[model samples]
Target chain A: MRYLLLVYAAAEEAAALDTRLALELAERGGLLAAHELEPVTTATSVRVRGAATLVADGPFAETCERLGGVYVVDLESLDEAIAVAARLPAARDGVVEIRPVVRREG
Target chain B: MSSVATVFREEFGRSVAVLARTLGDLDLAEDAVQDAFATAVERWPRDGAPANPGAWILATARNRAIDRIRRDRTLAGKRELLARLEREAPPAPADDDALPDERLALVFACCHPALAVDAQVALTLRLLGGLTTEEVARAFLVPEATMAQRLVRAKKKVRAAGIPIRVPPPEALPDRLRAVHATLYLVFNQGYGPPPRDELCDEAIRLTRLLAVLLPDEPETLGLAALTLLHDARRAARLDAHGDLVLLEDQDRSLWDEARIAEGRRLLDRALALCRPGPYQVQAAIASLHSDPEPDRRRIAALYDRLAELAPSPVVELNRAVAVALAEGPSTGLALLDALAEELDGYHLLHAARADLLRRLDRPGEAGEAYRRALALAPSEPERRFLAGRLHELPNGG
Candidate 1:
């Protein structure tokens, strides 16, 4: 199974996403990819409404906790994904939302 | 309570636990076991009983699960489940007769922290209480559909969240054990409350006894088992023949189960010997004292003080005041009760206790008012009747 872990944190805290942690997961063949977002200021949000395309000023909506980073990891179970999430630096000061990645496997 | 019902409850929970351990899927385990029970219901009467019902149930449920999985492999993630099932060894002939008791694992799964507390209680009852979803819903006073949805969501969360279905790791034992104890206590209390469901109480005791045996080293487990036993010891005396409430002082001593009281005292002593005091142990200790022919009220009051420190709740304080009234005087108890009035105004028992103390103090007027307040808020018929009777005893109230 694969899970997408989205870290909700301030840009400063999200900037602390651990490269060493990613490398460690990669070594274990569990890390598919992980990235810290550049910054919210340089982002644009787009939505489709009826026949019109709407563009927004920021990433989705401005909030205290922005979408700071994301990690997609392949693991056998949700517990394993949670173990990885617990290791993320952003988790110390912010929240990490874990959603099991939908897979179409035979 | 019949022969068949006894066999059904015992077999249902144990088989689900064992099968769940082997199959690694709660829904599959439960469904297959239900299917097996359905077959037994149809076939047992005509064919007579099996030599070993546990083995028979396990074998039948395993076959049903494999068939269900093989037939419905497209159900997402079940392909993995089927593949895993295929790799597992098939149940042996009569050698597989006595299934390993892995009900504790099912217990941990049902009481897993990932699920909400309400979900935890309901799941424990459904999975371990040998209760159908409808029975569980009725026990908790919820609609069957709502309870079914809650159980469904809890199982989904347990599956998707990768909550392990085995006894928790030792390092995490203390916290996990607290949750398991609390869930069981809640079940027992629900059963012990007015218009009581003796079946739920029995199930809670049955499971907690299993827990104490499995984890004998854990004092609180033994403490909880003791607590339930002590309370249940007086079951026959809780109400009159007409089902009106019977105050403890008025209850016939002959109706109390001496053997259960003795067993409860022994368990409490064992828990205390552990020297790791907990709220359950204290509660059990109080119950043991109450069971004594000549209970020491002073000690009961002091234990309640300790209980307040341990649990820190208004309920404990209210109990303490009752003990104080018996130990000290009605005036002293009444003063303590008055302090708790604002905090426990919503609790009918507090008002009832206050009325009793006031009546003892010869203040019929205040006692009548308190009794009326209690009668207004008492949650059940017997309790209301008891309070009304007390109100009529008051000079002004009559």
Candidate 2:
């Protein structure tokens, strides 16, 4: 099973992270297949209509924290995924929300 | 009260859940079960613990339900609902089968996300912990009416939204469990921290123990229990004879509860052995570092670094700032705390940390500003006073 780990953080705090070291740790743990997003200056959320995506300036839900990054991790079970998730530097007081990715045309 | 009444009260929850399953309407199920228990309490002393106590309760409940259905003119349309309930609620052979999923169902139902966070906590404590609204209110330092309204509204939302009474599917369990664990943690934290209400702390511990029992296989659950125990182990040492905030490093090592710390450490080790790293497990790992008699700030800083990466947030960063202060120096931590202040404007601990860092840097003016901010945002009397005391040390504290 594959899960998406959403990393949330304040912008400055996100900037101070040891991205290289984090990636190294993830790679050693086989969680390296995940992608790193460029820190976004702007975020626009969209909802699809009949033929259009209605874009808005931030997320659909506004929170103090923003989605700092995301990781697409493959693991055998939620337990294993959680283990990997726990190791992510992002799971402290800030949360790393883990949701299973839904496959289209599976 | 008689033995039957005691039994009825003890089994009230199981009876309610069983009845709810049979009746398919929570309100009706609750009334009928209460009526059954009432009858049992009145008759059981005279009748003795029935050969099958469940059957006696079920029989009484069914008959009472039937009478209510027949008597309520407006509920004539609900005859099918009533009949179905009565049919399903047959006399139990032993009553042991009555609530197979009673505790679980109640917990899940109470923890439904449709309700607000406060509502979830209040409802869970009420339904599973068997606590009254007044008791919960007192535990939370809120008024009974406020808590009562919160529970009432929560139940209404659960019924109105048709929230199911089952633990979410495997995929959904993590998030749901997070919420449930959070509510439980909050309860425990409330108990273990300020006001020093030992009973509420014990109640929260009891509730978490139940959760630990239910989800023994989940390392996160065990982690939560362990984290609670670890923090709780030092509860007595957190305050002094003068009732001041005692920093972890400054706390008297002898005052810490070795037994509780040992249990917590064991649970944390077991959780780590499972290699299932979730939020709770990560938090537990942090707590485990603190549980040491002579905690290594560098090791704790490394764990915080991993934790900050695993769960990046302002709060984590704030914690890492403290760890950095310990592992590196107050100056190194000051930079991190300053950066955190931009986004964590209203967070009390951020200001407190900033103040501490400033004080260490000998920047008295800035430290006073930070202390004022902390005092402004402090959530409790003790915290406010502590911040105020820190400010008093600053030149011309305004």
Assess each model's interface with DockQ, reporting 2 decimals per model: 0.42, 0.02
Predicted candidate 2 versus true structure: per-residue lDDT over A1-106, tens digit per residue: 5677787665525632336645764766646455545544476778999999898876666676667777766655444556556665666645677676643330
TM-score of each: 0.87, 0.68
Expressed as tens digits, the lDDT of each residue in A7-84 for candidate 1 is 877555356467888999999999998887867787898999999999987787777777788999988766567778
Clash pairs, candidate 1, are none
Local accuracy by lDDT, each model: 0.84, 0.72
Q: List candidate 2 segments past 4 Å from native.
A: A1-106, B1-12, B29-99, B190-193, B196-199, B393-398
Give the per-residue lDDT of model 1 (tens digit) for B25-64: 7898899989988888887887886766767777788789
Off by over 4 Å in 1: A4-47, A55-97, B1-4, B77-80, B90-98
RMSD of each: 3.4, 12.3
Q: What is the per-residue lDDT of model 2 for residues B253-342, given as tens digits with 9 covering 90 to 100?
A: 899889988888887888888887876777777788887767788988888888887778889889998999989999999888888777
